[model samples]
Target: MTGKLRCAVVGTGHLGRWHADKYAALPDCELVGVVDVDQEAGRAVADKHNVPLYDDHLAIIGEVDAVSIAAPTSLHYRIARDFLSAGVHVLVEKPITTTLAEADELIELAARHGARLQVGHLERFNAALMDLDLQNQPPRFIECHRLAPFKPRATDVSVVLDLMIHDIDIILSLVDETPERIDAKGVPVLTGDTDIANARLQFPGGCVANVTASRVSMKMERKMRLFLPNGYVSVDFQNRVLTRHQPGEREMFPGIPEIVSEESVFEDGDALMAEIRDFVACIREGRRPLVDGQAGRRALATAIQISEQLSA
Candidate 1:
């Protein structure tokens, strides 16, 4: 806890490579090694960062203080459990595990071992969202749409888990309440699982969130709008833009209230680095992560509920 923490990145694919890069760049941590089943891909990232590469995580598990698990969804639970059992802090990508039971087990394991478990809800670190003033005013109504052209990489899971879960995690964080009711519908398009899906969640305090996600869109779009008591806010996640609208004193027409709008753009912020830095800081300071295992579990549970409803 005094000197630099030794960290490793498991699974050096498209996203995992970035994790390795960030760790290498941070002065507070040392990039110990990289793990990937694909030797060529793993070696490429390891060589780029000047780190060692390993095919299996267990070989280097005890050598590192912490690890970033970017493996496939199915392997998340097992890999995370192994590291947590070894008393190593972990930062795993979203949808903590394939099932709620697995997520619960990991959470318990992390707690029993006194190791930090941070979920990679990357959007929680989005610069646009971080710039917004979302403190006192909770959103009463929320709408989210995440669309992307078909990609075979993440087709192993449904759109609900792959895409909608991001919005779900954000919404759950804002609402701070479990959904009382969930209604959903979806269909499989390109993959065996649901390619496009929609879900309406009703929270305990009359807050409602309507979410839609698709991997079969012509254009990519990631946006979320929130209707608060005093004003409205819209965020373009892809562009890192935030726009807010509130009632003005004067009206354009008699007896009508005019609207005032303001916009903020963040073009040069690195959310991934911020997220990883926070994980490292939490480990050093003994603080909880912004998005912990329980939060990820809640989002995954809700997503699974919606997926079940879609099937039913």
Candidate 2:
């Protein structure tokens, strides 16, 4: 915990390369190695960071204190299990794994081995949400939309797992209870799987969420609106802006309260770097992460419900 912690990044793809960059730049971590079955991709990242490169994750199991598993969703469970079994802390990418059973097994492995298991829900570290506190003020209704143009890189899963799950995770974090009812609809466009989908979730405590995600959209947007008891909150993820509207003392008309509005534009920052920094800090301090394996499993459970409903 005192000396620089040794760290490595597995699957040096697009996002994995970024993880390597952060570990190389962090003073508290020494970039131990980068791994990828694709020799060209892994070597590129490793040479760029001046670190060792490996084709398999097992080679660095005993050498690293922590690792970032940015491999494909299908391989998440296997890679994470191996690392956790070796007592190496892990930061696995979103959707946790292909199934809830896999997620549960990984979580149990981390506990059994006494290692930290964090999920890469990168949006949780966004600056736009830094001031928003949903703990004390739960919203009665929530609306979310995440849209992006078609990209072949992430077509391995449906839009529900690829995009919608981010918002699903955020909403689940806001409300501790799982949804009591789920209604969903989706269709296949470019990919054999559903490229666009929408789900309506009703929680046990009367909270409701309507979420829509599309990978075939013409434009990109990431936004969420919350209707609280005393105020309205809006988060523009693309622009990093948080806007709130609350009732004021001065009335605009008889029996009507004036609405005071405030908007905050956050500075452009790197959310991935913040996520990595937190992972390292949690490993050093021996504490639970913001998005632990349990949270990831919760998100995956809800997403699976929506996906199954859509297909049925």
Candidate 3:
């Protein structure tokens, strides 16, 4: 709240290492420590970031005002529960936890402890996504495709949790309504878990989102197309570009044209850094986080439905 907020990066694996670097480089945050089950890897990240390393999170939980939980999906609930119980604000990575019950418990824990819980839906911080004027109206229909080549690093969970959950969170945020029904299906291609998946979410507000994510694609692509009453918005995550097709006025065309295209490229910014900044800002200002626990729960609930359907 004062000079600099102390922060720790937990689960110093691939993603957590980057989280540690961001905290270390943030002007208003002091990187207190990096915690990981792998002591050597944790120490390496700490050394690189010039922060202390701890194999156990308990040692540093009392010291940091806020922490980023970038650990595996399986460990999210336990680690975050412990930190939040200690009154430490947490920024947890997506799919919040393996089960919806776990997510609910974490949300309750944060509320009970008066600690802020922010989910790591980093796309919300993307400059391209942030520029969208989603204030007045929610999306009517959405399509998302997040495809990537297989990487052995994040195989602990299914592609739904590993990748599709990102789009699920984004769609839920845009729609802002409870999904009435979700018809989903997926297949395991490369790993033991489902690799490529698709879900059609029907929201009570009549907004439908057709989401697909695959980790076995030959070419990498992360894009979403939003269709609203007034216009269509297309976002390219990898390219940092947002294009809109809105109806043009009489000056631009004889009558109102069916659509007029406008393209814009966002200034290159680090989304992960922005996400961490938001977490620190919320912790400092006592302002509610953009992707709060409720938002995360919505996404997680949708994902759980998809997974259940897939399993069935």
Candidate 1, residues 1-312: lDDT per residue as tens digits?
Answer: 899999999998878999998999998899999999999999999899888899999999779999999999999999999999999999999879999999999999999999999999999999999988875998899999999999888677899999999999999988999999999999998889999999999988999999999999999999999999989999999999999999899997999789899999999979899899999999999999999999999999999999999888
Clashing pairs in 1: none
State candidate 3's TM-score.
Answer: 0.95
Residue-by-residue lDDT tens digits, candidate 2, 158-244 = 999999999999999988889999999999999899999999999999999999999999999999999998899999888889999
Candidate 1 segments exceeding 4 Å error: none
Query: If scored against the real structure, what TM-score would every candidate get?
Result: 0.98, 0.98, 0.95
In candidate 3, which residue pairs get closer than 3 Å at backbone N, Cα or C atoms, i.e. clash?
A: none
Q: Which order, best to worst by TM-score?
A: 1, 2, 3
> What lDDT is reached at residue 276 by model 2?
94
lDDT for model 1, please.
Answer: 0.93
Q: Which ten residues in a row have the lowest lDDT in candidate 3?
A: 249-258
